[model samples]
Target: MAVGATPKIRLSLSEWGQMFIAFGALAWPMIKALFGNAPWRMFGSVEARRDYWRNVALVMIRTGGHWFSIRHLQFMMPNDRSACRLWGWMNWTSVISEQVDMTHGAGEDSAAKTERNPSIHWVGQSPQPVSTTGNNSQRSNVKVVLYIHGGGFVLPLSNGCITMMRTLLRETNDPSYGSPVYLALAEYTIAPYAEYPTQIRQCISILHRLSSRYGVDPSNLVLVGDSCGGSLCLSLLSQLLHPSPKLPQLPYTKGSSEPFAGVLLMSPWTSLATSAPSYTSNAGSDTLPPNVIRRFRDTYLPKSPDLSPTSTSGAYKRVDPMQVASLSGRYYDAVPDPPIKGLTDGAGATRHMDSFDAGNNKNDEWWKEIGSVAKRIMITTGEYECFRDDIVTFSNDLKHANDTSHGKASEIELLRDESFHAVLVSDFAFGIPPCTLAAKLSGWFLSVLRNPVV
Candidate 1:
């Protein structure tokens, strides 16, 4: 490595494969078995759902397997009365969705036909009639939620998030919350396939679409997100507040609802442009097998693809949310250039500048980008069990972010002294107060959703 010069670290295909093989050897059990949770059974009984994964996790752990993802970690939780208390509200699809993506909107998708729990109705009320497959007359003046879920820029409808979604809905009306919860959860698209602005676009699109169908009121739209989903919602709001002229406009149409009533986040990564003190401190505590937990800074850069798969020059610039450079880079991306520049399109084209080709070929460029997309995400790990830092940094950042930009009006909450990365959600499994303390942060979102402020 030379001063003021970038180092070139190139490897042959066999070397790359071997490197991934070695990494995969460590990652596979954790990912396939330990990193993820068991899939939902075909309408399994509550008891079956409750015991199935826990039992498997316990067996695996006792047999020398260790917890990596939240799903596998549940086995180590108590599952006693305390765990029941903590997990009480957290055992539903709604709570799981909220925990994973941090939105109720995913649960409320018109594409999804939910169980007719008429107990839950459209609570939004807007000035203009919202488009809906159903009649608006049946709607009530109840509140609704705009939720976002977490997945590493991929993995739509991911496993084990439904429980948290259910918990969120329960939190809306729990004795802890002082009311019942009613929300519409939404999901968004991820990078590589969707590109930079698409993530935000999907979120706004959902809101616009829901406006007509759900009759969501802007002031009453309680926004919530967890993990990347939390970051997504906040970034979406930030983008909404500050739109780029180059971007298309999405206003209050018959499909989209008004802006959020309030916002709620759990272990949210709100400040995309900077790294909190916790990124390195709690890196070890994160349960993600590789760089799954934290965001990578480079990923946010322009990522239009080439047809060839071997073009290293055209690697999609994925980013780590824990790094300040990542978010700061986004601002740079938004910089407006002088109109005199003979540019056909806006947002300075990073598209089609292939280190390889996008046209027909062996085309490992696109394939390599796809392969690396999963690899390049934030690999959160350290020698210490320091998962608390990820959430703490986020919570603090949210408060400070609001304070600096909008005078600190944001009210984000955090669970005290909890290792949020791997074991956070398991508080409901076998925790002391168990999931209660763990779910408190989640409950915050639910409370705000059910009874949004102003």
Candidate 2:
């Protein structure tokens, strides 16, 4: 109901039971918020936090789209819109005023604005000025990380994103290299206010500005996103990999032709049309409820039924499920058509097919482009995440595309952890300092910078 629409499919009795359990589990958190300390705050150890999150995941599974839908969050839109407009006006004013105050030495005004304007803030630890050491060549090569926060395309930037960005900027700063990594946090428009593709265009525009106005070399640039922000990262990367007429183009990025140095995707929600094996298999362990994933997809994407030959009634007629199963261990071309009635029926079997058109046909070419460029691609997912299956399939397909295009092996580093969806971003809440994760990302960036990907 929060999504402004009813569930796409009817729930069975067991699903209703799970939903009830979910509601009951959430009651404790609701009460905690109203009376005592928040659950996340109360849990000081990783195990305690994990236990809390597991319960939270159960609630999410039950509540799914029922509470966080566009319809449910409509009341908060006016504030979100006003905040966005205010930030836009502030950004424009700052740019104009910065130029005007140059003659007057108006550093006071700039500092004051930075302190007061809080809607969407940029945390930049200005890269250190490269020393005149003989390593002057390294000074010109700067790594700018433009982070897009994810809240299922509904909620605005979260504290987790802020914390992560802050740590990222700090850890990435190599006082050794003049001008440490420049990091910018981009706040894009969300749904029920700005429709689909609007945020995508905004992100591209920002990237263009960063590359052109800020003088960030695309070769030294690395894009990182998590959760839905990860989804946007993928979408934007797809656009950059293959700029097509069908895809919206930003003027600044139009002529520039160079691939990013690397991309880091953390628990990215890759598909929006249908359910995956993990949707049901990991439902108990995953922090996101199965229906919640469905709800987010419905609220953000076009209202099209997942025609993934597996989701349709025609699968049995068109392809053989048995034949598809035989090819399960390896990548197969044909995706058997079907109504995919098994998952809902408690048949938690893995869907052997990967290339079923989940409405990503238009972006297939873009995926190929990513393969051809063969930029350092790192995808990490929770073993129990509902998105595990899709993410795995996408990574496999991407590797294939890269290998086929380059006539050589293109390896995509697929890392798995015994964690839940968005564990990296949500680590802080679960008593897990994100330093370990930040170190990994920083190390990855350093590796790329050390051996510039041609």
Provide the overall lDDT of each model, using Cα atoms, as 2-decimal numbers: 0.37, 0.51
Best-matching candidate per TM-score: 2
What TM-score does structure 2 among the candidates reach?
0.63
lDDT of 1 by residue, 342-424 (tens): 11111112111121132322222212221111101111212232233444543444344434542114343444543333233
Ten-residue region with minimum lDDT total, candidate 2: 95-104
Q: Which stretches of candidate 2 lie over 4 Å from their true place?
A: 1-25, 29-121, 125-141, 250-256, 303-366, 371-374, 407-411, 435-439, 449-454
| Residue 426, candidate 2: alpha-carbon lDDT | 65
Name the 10 consecutive residues with the lowest summed lDDT in model 1.
Answer: 370-379
TM-score (all chains, Cα) for each model = 0.49, 0.63
lDDT of 2 by residue, 64-101 (tens): 33333333333333333233345445435221110000
**Given candidate 1, what's the lDDT at residue 122?**
22
Which number leads on lDDT? 2
lDDT score of residue 131 within candidate 2: 39
